[model samples]
Target: MITKIAQIEILPGQEDAFEKAVTEALPLFLAADGCDGVDLQRSVEHPSRYRLMVRWETVKHHTVTFRASDAFTRWRALAGPHFAAPPKVEHVYPVLAH
Candidate 1:
């Protein structure tokens, strides 16, 4: 599986609204093609900073398929306004525990 992480920094004082929006948009992420799951996590040291973690079956499932679909448009519409800047996103694979 591929893990996609989006590093987002919210606008000042918009944390609550942003969180609510993200919660409401969870289904969009889940409904994407090859999507496994997604999690929105807030930073303890930086209240306005968030990391959006999404698991997909492949990197292209997220980068190409999802990004080209309406869900991506909807996702941006929901969370784009609150962003301090465009998110820094990347995909990764899990490391072996052993």
Candidate 2:
């Protein structure tokens, strides 16, 4: 599997609401084709920053399939308003595991 890591930045005072929106959108990610798991993590030194990690069967599942789905539209609708800037997204494969 591959993982998509999205570095998100929310408006200064919208962190809570942004977190809530992502929480609410969990089901969307879970239900998506090729999606294995999803998680959101807050930065220790950057309160307005977050990382959205989603495991996918392949990169195309996220970049092509999911991006073209209605769920993606809904996700953006739910969380887009709080974005301070466009998210920085990348997909990576596991290089090592204990």
Candidate 3:
């Protein structure tokens, strides 16, 4: 499986707005071909920071399947403006598991 982590920092008072936007935007992933699942988490120490952890069958599933789809465009249109800056995205592969 491939994991994608997006670190989003919301502008000061935009936390509630960002979270609401993300919640509304999440359904777009359901239409993605290889999207296994996605989870959103917030930083306890930093209310304005959030993390999106997504799992896909392969990296190409995200880079190709999802990114190429119209849903992505809509998703971005809905969620893009809430970002403090462009999110920092990272891809990772699991090395160990319990």
Candidate 4:
């Protein structure tokens, strides 16, 4: 599997709203094809920073398939407004895990 990590910075004062929006959009990721799991984490030192992690069967599952779907549009609609800047995204393969 591959994991997609998106580092997002929310607009000041919009942190709570951003988190709520992401939580409300969980089903979009869960129901996506080839999606294995999804998680969101906030940085304690940077309250406006968030990391969105999604596990997929392959890189294409996220970049090609999901990005082309209506769900992608919906996701952006829900969360885009809170963004301070476009997110930085990357994919990683597991090196070791329990």
Q: Tens digit of lDDT per residue, candidate 1, span 1-98?
A: 98999999999999999999899889998989999999889999999999999999999999899999998898889989999999999998988856
Report RMSD (Å) for each prediction in the order shown: 1.0, 0.5, 1.0, 0.7
lDDT of 3 at 13: 92
List model 3 lDDT by residue over 1-98, tens digit each: 98999998888898888778878878888668888888999999988889988898899999998999998898888777888889999999989989
TM-score of each: 0.96, 0.98, 0.93, 0.97
| Deviation of model 1 at 70, angstroms | 0.7
Return the lDDT, model 3, position 45.
98
Residue-level lDDT of model 4, residues 41-88, one tens digit each, is 999999999999999999999999999999999999999999999999
Between prediction 3 and prediction 4, the one with superior TM-score is: 4
The backbone clash count of each candidate, in order, is 0, 0, 0, 0
Error of 3 at 33 (Å): 0.4
lDDT of 2 by residue, 2-93 (tens): 99999999999999999899989999999999999998999999999999999999999999999999999999999999999999999999
What Cα-based lDDT does every candidate model obtain?
Answer: 0.94, 0.96, 0.87, 0.96
Better of 2 and 3 by TM-score: 2
Native-structure RMSD, model 4: 0.7
Q: Can you rank all candidates by TM-score, best first?
A: 2, 4, 1, 3
Over 4 Å off, model 3: none
